[model samples]
Target: MSNLVEFNETSAPGFVLLGFTERAELRLLCFFVFFTIYAVTLAGNLGVVVLIRLDLGLHTPMYFFLSHLSLLDICYSSTIIPQALWSLVVAKPGISFPGCVTQLFSFATCATTECYILAAMAYDRFVAICNPLLYSVLMSQRLCVGLVAGAYLAGVISSTIHTVAIFHLPFCRSKKIDHFFCDGPPLLALSCSDTHLSELVVSALVGFNVLSTTAFIVTSYSRVLAAVFRMRSPPASRKTFSTCASHLVSITLYYGSSLFMYLRPSSRHSLEDDKVVSMLYSVAIPMLNPLIYSLRNADMKRAMRKARGRVLSLATRGSQAPERRGGPLHG
Candidate 1:
């Protein structure tokens, strides 16, 4: 038993993230680009939240889920963009063990939440389109609240399991993580311990989350298509399809990139290539979410205009109040 130890215990305590490796001159360029994305992500998502709150017309189940999606985008971008921007600007892009784990946990949580939220949105569309008469009854305020709560709970549980499985692995060799963020695949590659359990768990979660949600979405859309087709009137069918097109596009882009990254076997792990793919879902998707929703959604555009006007009016009133108070010719 005493002679069973195979390797020494000393190991690197942290990791150096290689980030983007195209060119050194691209560092500033990348930083500015990502900074713009982060700003837009925050403003767009927060704008949606504010619009949903201020506009009575948007106080429905659809907008409620939209608001939560916006919030998830904000949280998701916040988890990765800041650190990524810092890594690009700073000389070193190092992360401690605990920091890496925390980042991984938050990222996984937001991502899982987005998956479930998309499914909920799909279901909402089903009810709204397939059974308009009972839409409100099926998707009451209580039900909406329950669905949002369930999404968050599912996210937390999935993240907890993944993070725990990851941290339990022993790290005894190279600690360099070759990605902009702490993702499951990259972290798994760095583990010296036998990662069969972790790999299996990650694969199972990915399969269950993506495949299950995809099935639900497909079923909902199938029923939706059938309903629209049976209407027989071209205009009505077109309108129904238009209503779901934006959501379908979003779902395709999101799950497409995510599935490409996670669902593949571990033998296909290429840190350099995987990093590029991860950016699509992590950075690009968040930036595109608001554009997709706002451009396609008339209610959101109107609400945004009203909210902007309100802000401008308040600013003008604030400026005039100071001037009126300071006037000296009052009798």
Candidate 2:
């Protein structure tokens, strides 16, 4: 294995990221589409983070996780979208070995981090709903920081392992990756070496991540629902349902698509289908996260309105101040 690594590393193979080459006419269309999605994703996620920070009303554990989730969305899109848009326009779109490794590491890190973060959020929600009284003490600032730190550490560990595993393998002749980005599926497909071990390792790692987080989410939500059902107040029931609904939708979209894409054999993955799914999870989901949270939740809408009003008020005052200074003071 050591000798083989030397040979593969010495060759310094590159990869070509062929992004959505179905129709030449549609390249421009796809470019614009991806551009629009990336733009919206940036605006929405950043807006969420900014709103959470500026608004004291949202200084709870839930909003802390949400702000981090938005930050993760921003990182997620940045990893894949720009290069994808570039691929559409460039004549021979290829990334060097180092560049591909960097891309893989960043993508994996963000994804793995998000998985744990979501789970942490589920636990937060659980405590909030199931044990409203102890929620404050249970989800203290110290514990929140620890959970977030643990998520990041998990991401780093996962990314480091996968990146080393994939790159260590011997990539002989084939350098052209069928889909966009240096995803595990496509990268493994390109490897000339036996990927059985890599696949098993990845499966175990990703499966553990997916299963553990999912199990926690399921357990937490189950308890939450049970607690909500026993509640006598109608408004309380409605509030609890709304809070969980957004998370359920988010988890479903991300986990469902990702499980389908990654938890399968590389041979079973069709290039076209893989590309579409990748775009759906990596590109579309980020743009949707903010909308899912803001549109579904009343508090978010209120914050947005308040934020907008503040901006408008500032603009109004600025305009009046300029007028007053120019008209009376200068004269």
Candidate 3:
């Protein structure tokens, strides 16, 4: 009993996050690269949210869900990137046990919420394409609100489960986490207790989330394609395809990387490999989402132009007002 008490007392209460690499030059390069990505991600995702909100033309089921998605991306990226950037430059990048748990919960919530949001977006497209006449009626405002709420609720529940289950276990082993962020597998590796059930719980939840969302999206898109092919008007079909194309790209980037990261067997889990893959789904995807949606979708392009025009007009008017006031004649 005394030896056990000594062992527990000697273990650190905080965790050391050994970031991507330890070399000084590489750390500098990583810091700059990730800082730039974080800036772009914040600007792009926030722009999407603001644009959707301000532009009345974008007030539809598609953009409604898209706005929520942008918020999620912002949150998702924020949860990981700042800490990672800090960890890169610091001599000792450590996080308290509470902080680690908080990060895990935050990161998990954003990720899971994003999964359902993407699925919801797919369903919105399904209704619009597959049930054109009844699109608005089916995807009513109340229903959309409920869907978003449900996604968040589901995320919170899943995160709580994972956080409680993992942190409750004793982590008496080495305090050095092998990855950048406080992710599940690395944290599990630090535990002195058996983590079989925790592993099972994580795998089950992740599998269910990933597979279910992917299935819904695939099924939705399949029906959409069939409906498009059946359309007699080539232009209409093209337009339908164009609208769905941006969504397809976003879905591919997020789900493809996430599936690669989470759904793999534990035996093949490599910390080094996991960092690169996690960077994709967590960091890169958020930066790409706004660009994907805006650059490809005609509506977003038009909205950008209109918003630009408004800003330019406001600036011009403001300048003219100052000049008019300074001039002698037009009082």
Model 2 lDDT per residue over 66-155, tens place = 999999999999999999988777644778889999999999999999999999999999999888899999999999999999999999
TM-score for every candidate vs. truth? 0.89, 0.93, 0.94
Worst 10 residues of 2 by lDDT: 1-10
Tens-digit lDDT string for candidate 1 (1-331)? 2222222223435677767853657877898899999999898888788889889999989899999999999989999999898777655467777889899999999999899999999999999989999998999989999999999999999999989988888866676677898899988888888998999998898789889999999999999988988997898788788878889999999999999998888898788779888989999899899889988776777888888899999999998997788787572
Note the clash tally of each candidate: 0, 0, 0
lDDT (C-alpha, whole model) for all candidates:
0.86, 0.88, 0.89
Which predicted model would earn the best lDDT?
A: 3
Candidate 2's displacement at residue 293, Å, is: 0.8
| Clash pairs for candidate 1 | none
Model 2: residue 146 alpha-carbon error in angstroms: 0.4
- Among all candidates shown, the one with the greatest TM-score: 3
Sorted by lDDT, highest first, which candidate order results? 3, 2, 1
lDDT of 2: 0.88
Query: How does candidate 2 fare on TM-score?
Result: 0.93
